[model samples]
Target: MEILRGTVAANAKPTKPSFVSYVTPEEIKSESPRPYTPKTVKCPHLLPGEVMFCSANTVVKETQDDLSQRGVFGTLLCTNFRVSFVSDEEPTEDTTQLFKNKLYGQNDIPLSCVDHIYGGYEDKRKLITTGSLVKNKCPSKLIFHCKDLRVFTFVLTYSEEKDAKMIFQGIVHHCLEPKSLKNLFAFSYCENTACPEKQRKQRTMMFDCAEDWDLDMKRSRGVCRLVTENNNFELSPDLPQFFIVPTHVTEADMCQFHGKGLPMWCWSHHSGCALFKTSTLPLLPEDTIAQAYMEKMLTAVAHNYLFSVKTEDLSDTLPTVQDIQLAYSKFKHFFLIDNTTDFWMSDMKWFSSLDSCGWLDIIRQCLQKALEVVECLETENTNVLITEESGSDLCCVISSLVQLMLDPFYRTLPGFQSLVQKEWVAGGHNFLDRCNQLHLKDKENTSPVFLLFLECVWQLLHQHAPAFQFSETYLTVLSDSIHVPVFSTFLFNTHHHRATVLRAESPHSQRDPLNCPTVWDWSVQFDCRAQDLFLNPLYTEKPKHVKSVQRSRPTHQRQLSLPTACKTPPKKGFFKDEADSLKKMLRVKRISRWMLSPETPHPSSATREFYETWQRKPLDHHGLILPCLDGPSVRVWLQRYLRWIQEVQIFGGGAVTVLGKVSELQGEVRELQRRLERHGGSSFSSSNQQQQRAIRARTGTSTGPQTGGSRSSVRMSSSFPFTTLKHNWSYKPAIPTSVLQSLMASGNLADKEDDADPESIV
Candidate 1:
């Protein structure tokens, strides 16, 4: 007690919360001075101020520091289905009980449901003792939160002579049925010290994503009940959800949907996820031939990688997070190495899975073929087969490419042990630039079908990695820029790209006025009888339309097809809205609350392109109800201002864009006419004409190819367009600032030649 007290600031009273003063003992050093906090909601073993109840001599903040020979992470599997048989109402209770006892493992014994337990153990002193029974008295079930937003009830008793801890692994990754535990969701956080920029971004993103997702869920579930009683920011303590969702329906609706529905306001806004790049691989046009095999082939692919992907690493028989991260890392490297082995160069189960037994050889062959031009990647390669038919068998190319792009970034996430040496970030970005370069230099060496594989790989990396380097700059400004749409277009322009996860602040002026509600309208509001809530009464009448539409025609389509080059999309919710009027009637709930002084929406750089900033200064609040008005009509002055800004942002951009195009056309016309006079055999008179003729004659003479030509001879570069260039300067140059200042004596800071890298161009 004395030791803990002495560490506190000398002037501070003991009554203060530990956070205001240093509570960590001086003898122990923290991992990082900055003391980073996770922005995203996460449940690490030792969150700040968390304490494990103990009657020991002393307890240390670090669980590992206090315990001896303990695992940092743990897993425990529950095998007590018989415990639930008391629910006589469930008819399956008997069958479920028999099924539980009948369960068998690989050896086919009537196995114990809980075969193993994972957690930390302290062998030195049995700290958890009830009446000195030592470890034997430890409770098998201690309640705590999990990173995956789950609270499980474990029933196990500990028996250790010394103090011990059971490490709780983030997720349950054992038993074939564990995959069903996904009504639970997870998010990311930084375990790293805060000073690292990468960690900072990741931590912030995790929190922001969580917050935004929660808002979406609340809004969608019903008109969200987020408004505080008196405009308080302190969220209502009674908010029902623990984990964030895209949107959430109300409790009754949630129970009805098996506790699932996009959380209101939790719209990732993915319905119209802006296309950064068009998919080069369009949806395979419908055909009876491909449709018949599509499911079977897709099943084969999913089965080929038969291992279950856990949300987090469990410590039992299942592989750890570190292992999965490593496997992902390997998957990325496969893209870089030209002659990398096929079996398991990237994915751990690549060549080892039961279904992949015969597929590896075929994939290797595909890789060899993929390295050739677009035509060669097809099953029947011919120079003329450049259409979709040519590259019909594209799965192998996709698989290999996925390996190359994804593995490296996935290696950077929290559970993975690989240290992202500070120097590697630039190298990672350059990898993509380099790929573009190689592809341009030798078009036949790689093709877009393979690039789709690269995109798939990136998709995996984005999913697993904590930090995605979507943007970079030397200084002045930084943007969360994905220019993914740009790179993706180069892959294939056939299918719509689904990299639909991005949110950033943009200017308020840029948002779509229509999208902004004048009022914070609720998602739905209805009240009749709370008792018959879950039942759908309308199912009694079956619609005749379903009977007539048994065949596989595109369910509903626009009367006309789009241009052959792009897809034709129906501009409404393509997914069945369910049109459940009875469900809708039962679910409409009212606005829980509204603040008279509503707050301004936070600005986002990325989402602002179609975002509108709304504030309720006075009239817009539309208190309780307005006479004969659906929404309050603003006085003439403000209404005009709102319309003006909205129209300018949405329509002004179009005008400026059109003006710029016209100017460009004018400049091009003048340049072309000048070129015609100089090279298009235009007859001219006078001395200027004579000079022009001489230039034309020289151009004609130099038109033929020259051997061993100098760069001054003006030959077109063979490399394709837009690949990044690498400079190979002969001399190491001194900084211009240093040279100029020194040479100027009484001083000027300016380059003698041109300012190569403009720090301030203006």
Candidate 2:
């Protein structure tokens, strides 16, 4: 296209000029129009048939191509498509318009090209003038932040404030408004004004052709690779192709393998990391097969941006590492007198078990393994493939721990249970077989994987108590539900696994989705207790569009032993005396260690009388106790058990309630302290000033050479030419009653939805 300058149309009307143009003598003379001048004419530079919305008579400061303002002035004219400035000096007939009418020191900037507007000054209303102040200063600068984060500043003179505000708001409006499809196609009404119908038909035909071409090309491309996982052909010949993990399995990537394969689930980070849990080779022993399939899965990542990881060597695989973890668990289980053995154990025997079991050591090991898997996914950005002999044991342990660590949603009760459903119950962890083994005392098959995961979660909750809503009571009750079989975790395994178990138990039982129990049933059995433990009181759901807060690892502190004996509270709630008495008895049964004496002592009448009023099973008890067990031992357990009513109903501090309001209050205090530091006295002002100083320091010198001569003499803003534009633009439209009401209604509805399911991911 050839460049055009100040040349006028041959048929140009003798109307007044709306814009002040420097190249045209007629337009330049109009800038200083006489009292009886005719109405303003359209800007000469505007395209044919383009309309002018408005124009203002204001002085413009010429700027370098670097966007630095120069010591030059001109009259500015803004049209629909572009903003053009004319030289301040009156044009003479001898002055030649270079390259058509492209005048020296004139800028024609397209309205479509402006990208951003920055206004950082604080509200002027706050800066009030005290007694007898003649005038108040207001910030009059606005910097436009545009493509490539480049900046240009503008300043409005006090006299032209009204015009400056209008132009500023208009430019911003043009920048934000979505461009119409017609604009994108460069179709204009003027192009077909002479034959409107014919032009419309041609435009429509062109659009139709483009649409058909795009459709055909897309159809030929087939489904996007992102949604499919069958790209890689690598698999073991003996194994089914479907058994291997998919190459790219994001959290949003759904499964298409009939609910098997244990597809890897990637988080939406650019780190190319993923997590998957798969069953070990059923026909091969753990030591015999190398986890080369894992490496193969990872190899696909180079092409697909997927990630997969496996333990480095066979020696460090789940079977060997978890074997050592389970050994420690067995050692503790062998000594501890749980509910099954509680009826038979003497006081001395119980004490000996508690003292010798070293349960804390097991807890430590469980925590370490969980942390290792978490670190892999988070810190190292490594993908992980966790597999065990049956996939239900240690594999379940690792998968659940990793999800809980990374997905903050699982920190709440419903989220926790959804994770259980997705990861354990639905993922095919053999809850039935494992719980059965524990019940039957089958040492070999019984793994402490579930317990290990719970302990790991406990460590996190214990440290970063504010980050989670559910208390330790929730975890304790959840663990208890496993033994209680009626809970869904124990009742339902995978569809095939559950179906098999049900078929054997009752051949005619219906196996429909409706017949299966949901995890919500926990509320049905113990509504009050479930509500207390299952929902977090501290959790505040953020809007769905809000970016999630980055989670930080809980600080590690030296693990503390369980308090040996409960000390009576100096002051308490209304039921303080009852609470202390019950706590004292509970602590004795839970943590006290007695010397092993052969003597069997008789119970006191007072203790016997106290025990008679309580008969129900203890909520926190893991050990089974026969009804025939002696009264004193039973009394100690029952008094604390009865206190659950007082605790739950009155004080809300049952034995199961681990972390109390004191810690929650502390967290709030810390948050307030941070806010204080952030907004204290002069700190906020000082910080804001520091940022302003930094921005000003980077601004180029405002004075530069005059307008273009040769290309080498012209300085551009980086590689692109830019003309600095002004600040102090304000646009505040009055809110309509209908719009205000609608906004309020929508906000209220969102709050209601949030309240309905407080634990849900917002």
Candidate 3:
């Protein structure tokens, strides 16, 4: 019976099992988890008044290193403040970094900083201009070229179509198509930013008011007086509200040509000569009256303080604004590279490319022009009037260069900032138009005039390192800050424009934008640690005794009395013999009188004396400095142009190695001095005296060219061009033990076999 049941069970096993359903299909579908879809992620950090306009998720940021071809998954965002990318992966912070920017992060690019934007689709790229978003389809890739030579690329293939389109449109609209100056982020930021009064007081001089001008004049011992005729900007919108003019000129003279073609005082020299700048009169050859008046105005300028004036037409001497723009346009391409292949491909023809660009030629021309002006003031004892078409472009350039060369006050950090304010901002340079901050697409109005001036300054700083109190890093950072919208220093075209903007009401809020901070307020962008990079450690302060000596020197007094009238020659009448006898007597009297008069100093001897005095004086950083205008003397600014390129970064090498060693030696000496003070104060004082004597003795010898009492040494490795162990024995270890230990812990340092001898290792 059991065998029969088993057979039946086996035959019935193929029947399907019965089931009962408790849940409906619709309910199951609703309860189940949905597929993962990218969603908009809000930006974690925003400025005081920043507003996010659009965002796209699942974006990929392409790394600049073309060899790696790596991509970072992130979310791309567009706000009024900047274009930012937030990565999905947690960012690993480098604690070892000595300097860090607080205003902008690694993935952030300010809207004003965006020089050009390109969109790529199907292996083709096109510039994204105004209304391009409406004319073309949404691009899969967007590339940003910044004014600071930074390039950023973002891929939007993984993002939703609508989200991608929204972000692209948002960036183009806000970054390139602002309708008015009020729309800039500066006004909004100023509205919300609560700048401390103490901090504002400590910032650089703006030269925006009459008091600042007065203070500047007093500092320079200027003989000209400040005029407030343009208090309401009535004379000319381009001219400052308050400016210095010759004592001979009146308010009525300033009204001529809307304040154009009038000599305005820039600075005064110790030799009773002054530097002046003016705008060119309109090119109306047919208007003889205007030309005649211009001549008369210039003649009056020449008589200022009873000194002759030399007029330098910069438009005739230096490159035109258009020429500058063209040269810079071609020059910037070699550095704004997207891939390693292109960079290396262009490296072989670098010098030829640079020459063809004509940028260095422009720099040379500017330096030559400044040197000429310096000669006029220093040697010729004549006032120099630098004139250009607008007086805002090259006028600012040449005038600023002259001051930097002749005036020691302009070489320090604060003085440099003040010089920029006086020459560029207060001088009415069209920074808004030149920098294209509004992205107006007006090519004629855009030129890197300020950058050219900075380049010229860099040349001086490079040639005379110890003369400047600021480092090259400071200049590099300052150049980058020009595009940052938070600073009011480079925002407007003129003092009047800045004033108008500050008083105007913001569209976003009821607050006035009067408290906008300037770039000199470094606290807004950098912490104290980063701010230290702006100061040069090798700077030697100008001696106090030198200033006193300059002040004590008697001012040169010129002969102010009118010459004696000459008696008319005896008329040759009937008594011709008598007339000849009278002329003979007069000639003999003049000869006797000339012979009896006191002997005067020869002009050449006076010049030789001046040269000897200048040479004999101990080197003064604040004294006259001449630059080498030779071809080989002009060098590329490596720290600026190549800083962004990773391949050119020489880790633990270059001048930094020598600078580090010097810093260590300085610390050791300081420590020793402190110990000696604790042990024997008198011995420490004697040691200081001995050091001073040694320095004086070293400076007295004419062994080599000197700058600031010390020979100008080339900043390079002591064992340059060779890698022998004997030559490198004097150098400290390149990497510290602590750094090596950390690198090992991070698995970044590779282990190597000990193949060298123990003596060589030591």
Candidate that would win on lDDT: 3
Candidate 1 structure quality by residue, lDDT tens digits, 273-334: 10000001223576554443322222221111111000100122222223433333333322
lDDT of each: 0.22, 0.37, 0.71
Residue 660 in model 2: shift from native, Å? 7.0
Q: After superposition, how far is residue 327 of candidate 1 from its true place, in Å?
A: 14
How do all the candidates rank in terms of lDDT, highest first?
Answer: 3, 2, 1
Per-model TM-score versus the true fold: 0.18, 0.36, 0.76
lDDT (tens digit, per residue) of candidate 2 on 1-762: 122323354345678768755553333444555786443532444443354554434444423122223423444455555444454454321232211112112244444333334442453212221210223232354344321122334444421555555555555444444443223111232232232122322121111122322332232221112222222212211112222234344323223222233333322212334555554443344633234433333343322222124341212433443464455454433322211122222221343443345444444544445444544444334445554555555666666665565555556555566556555654555564444422232335445456556765666665444456465545654554454323334643444544444344432443422222333454323433123334333333332233332123232111111111223223324334464444333211100011112242222232233223222424211111112123221111111112111111222222212223333353466566568967755233332233222211112211224323322212211111111112211122223445435435655534433123212323
Looking at model 2, residue 53 earns an lDDT score of 53
For residues 357-404, what per-residue lDDT tens digits would candidate 3 score against the true structure?
Answer: 999899988887777666556655566777888888999998999888
Residue pairs with backbone atoms closer than 3 Å in model 3 (clashes): none
Residue 272, candidate 3: Cα error in Å is 0.5
Error of 3 at 548 (Å): 5.1
Distance from true position, residue 385, model 3, in Å?
Answer: 1.0
RMSD of each: 31.5, 32.0, 14.0
